[model samples]
Target: MDTSPKIVASVVYGCCPTGEPTVPVHLPGRHGGPNRGELQTVNTYPAVPATAGFFTIPAHADYRASAATVAHTRSLSFLKPLMGGPCFDLEAIWDEHTRYEFADRSVEETMATMVDEPYVNHVPTLTGGIGRAKLTSFCRDHFIFSNPDDTALELVSRTVGIDRVVDWLYDHARQTK
Candidate 1:
């Protein structure tokens, strides 16, 4: 018989600084074990209101010497020279675009962040179009205006290069008919 503690899924929680609350996290156990693919609710933190699902780390009013701050300062010092020339932060731009998308903003407002002509292709459905006019029409008709109210996006990772950024994300939405 195996006496060792079975390695379970790792769960990461983003917490608020104010209080340590119990948060329930669902974990799907591994297959073919004694706990055979069972859904388990692990109460981790103190209970927080359902509406307060997300938390932000509070910033200090005054600068303090911490390991993280020190590392950040050093990183900035190193990056300052490399980023000195006129450069655009693609991450910020992508974040703004994501916000606009989830908020279901106007197609014109969303397109403002893109080039004069842009193309989008939803490979699975083959639903997107090319050029500003067609893309704008597609967004207005099928995506921006028609997205569900509870639509959300989970950004897994982003790789920003000299001229392009590739983002891996999960789109969460409810189908409405």
Candidate 2:
């Protein structure tokens, strides 16, 4: 199978059953949503089978059913942790083909130095609900090298509260060996 990021996915944070988005207090160190709000323009909309809950802008809205979200999950409340590191900078992996890092160098400097996608800023422009830091960490820890596309699925899980499903998939992947 081919492992490539054919899509772009965003995971939103701070929402409840009815979809009330709040800013996370001292949100984790990662970069997405409000933490870097000044650098982005988010576009949002929702269409539901009621069960598919709600979904937001995805990384690769370029794909079919890419906006698809699992039913009955949709809760931004799950991401109450990770106001720290690791998962915070995970979005940086989105541009697998590019070379950028949040090291001692400024993100602006990195974005400006991008020799690949001249359109790419070291800072990614994202759209979606807020994302959970723990979930964000989990995705980076596991899929960083495999199918970063899994991050897309993870984002879907975060939007709704289907993290258990994500956990199951990861666990099953381990046990199958």
Candidate 3:
């Protein structure tokens, strides 16, 4: 009598429910064969039908869908825990920094968001500083106090990403000679 364990076919689904759909992957293990112990290589397959309460998996002619699904899963693995959690509002942080700059407030608060030893570089004028002391001094002497009382800044756009926010801004101020 045959007592070997019967291997069942397993299906790997994609993470995205709507964007990128994946076919139901069928692994080889039904009958007792050479690939009974090992998983069969999946080259191509038809996508699983989209039913109520189920995701619509897309069919791929080649291995593109499999590769994309893997990439998406890998990218979302770390973000799963952070999703719907207390996320940092970059816009509000930028507003606070701007308020500190325009109101001539304490540079300490502005520098709080930065690392232990932070550096700033004004690429255009090649003027900035390194470390807390130098950066604070530069902000006080060159940026905050030096600007006119009517100075204003216009925010063009802001691009927020995983760990950084890129702001496009235009400063409007009267030059005093």
Candidate 4:
């Protein structure tokens, strides 16, 4: 199965004759990714309150990461000198890292997404650590393994800046023990 990431960039028109842009609500794909070039007709979303206009749907389907994002990353791997600094999709990188850490629950895989010397600081608990070895230890013994089996995060909002992507999430978990 293809688990790469897909890009959704299609806009649908609605009943608004005044041409005011309708609110866009992303519809989840059935096969883990939205089908490419397929038009999704949604009168009302399952739980979300649908606005009076059409709902925007995903344009591409079933992707862990888009091919364009992958190619951009690969091309940048060779242009570090010319660019002077890394130039890649921050959102894609963040998504990949989180997927490895939370969903896959692989400390090694999570560490592979970070740098040689990285640091993690949990502001609420004032936990986490610095350096690769310390961070890896934290992930193995404290962070990832400590989560409950039913843990999930609902992203409320995300701000992607040039150098950073800040995500506001709501943690939904029921402690099993």
Q: Which candidate leads the pack in lDDT?
A: 4
Ranking by TM-score: 4, 3, 1, 2
Residue 18, model 1: lDDT of 27
Q: In terms of TM-score, how similar is model 4 to the real structure?
A: 0.50
Candidate 3 lDDT (Cα, 0 to 1):
0.54
Candidate 3 residues 1-177, lDDT tens each?
A: 024333222243332122222322223221232322222322222243222112223554323454445434433433433344345766777788778877656577777766789899989999889999999899878867777787887889988754456789888884568
Ranking by lDDT: 4, 1, 3, 2
lDDT of 2 at 34: 39
lDDT per residue as tens, model 4, 1-177: 024233222222233222222322223332233433333322222332233232232343322233334333333443343346656688998898888878889999899988788999999999999999899999999999899878877799998755567999888884568
Model 3: weakest 10-residue lDDT segment is 21-30
Tens digits of lDDT, candidate 1, 76-109: 4334444463467878887787677667476777
Clash number by candidate, in order: 6, 18, 1, 9
- Which has the higher TM-score value, candidate number 1 or candidate number 3? 3
- RMSD (Cα, Å) of candidate 1? 20.5
Pairs clashing within candidate 1: 21-45, 21-46, 22-45, 22-46, 22-47, 23-45
Per-residue error for 161 in candidate 1, Å, reads 1.3
Error of 3 at 101 (Å): 0.8
lDDT of 1 at 14: 35
Candidates 3 and 4 compared by lDDT, better number: 4
Give the TM-score of each candidate.
Answer: 0.47, 0.17, 0.48, 0.50
* Regions of model 1 farther than 4 Å from truth: 1-86, 173-177
